[model samples]
Target: MKYSKATDYALHTMLFLVAATPNKPIGVQQLADRQNVSPTYLSKILTKLVKAGMVESASGANGGYRLKRNWENISFLDIIHAVEGTASLFDCSFDHGSECPIQQVVLSAEAKMEEHLRNQTMFDLAKKNKNKIVW
Candidate 1:
């Protein structure tokens, strides 16, 4: 499945935060510049994360966002759900009335796909990155 840009930013921001030294609140501009994304776009991304209670925000001179929980506690599904809402890979309503046989197959396939995505977590993703990537 294709992940959205919002999910990409959220993942990058979380990984950057996870890699940061203790007690350092990363500024949005810094995250934007480092990730090479627009600051405005990152701000909007963070806003959704904040609303979902995945990340916390601070205000004033020494203000920025930090995770509400540890990296291990934050799941990819959690982030994806926050950014994109639930993965409704199937909607087999068939005009809101009839049940088509083709739709039944589609729904079953979608359910399996959804299960795979839901079972995935950021920690699992991090582990994969840990060996293959460096920065």
Candidate 2:
């Protein structure tokens, strides 16, 4: 059930973008500083987010990353999938086919978790914590 550090960073980065300045671009160095991570490493995560259409990048001075127009509709699941991919968390090693009882239980749990994540969006979180400093 564990997700990658990249996923964790991506989620936090999205939340920071939404809460701090949804419409304004934030530099990658600033974002990395906030998380105590390397800008180069964070850039890779941002690339995935860009490809997923969650965020867009700008070039030149005052250029960086900002939440996309449809960011309000982006769910947690979307961010997770962007970094982690859509593969099932648990794949039964035994060739018990799709009907494997253990696999079925794990998949069911994953579905419920995904459903919960899908219901929660960055906008919802940002709005809830509007008064607080995201970083």
Q: Which candidate tops lDDT?
A: 2
lDDT of each: 0.75, 0.94
Specify the poorest-scoring 10-residue window by lDDT in model 2: 126-135
The residue-by-residue lDDT of candidate 2 on 1-135, one tens digit each, is 589999999999999998888889999999999999999999999999999999999988999999988889999999999999999998788999988999999999999999999999999988988888546
TM-score top scorer: 2
Where model 2 places Cα greater than 4 Å from the true spot, the runs are: none
lDDT of 1 by residue, 73-130 (tens): 6766678788888856566545753367777777787677767867776666666676
**Deviation in angstroms for 134 in model 2?**
4.0
Clash tally, candidates in order: 1, 0
User: Cα deviation in Å at residue 134, candidate 1?
Assistant: 4.0
Lowest lDDT 10-residue stretch of candidate 1:
89-98
All candidates: TM-score: 0.76, 0.96
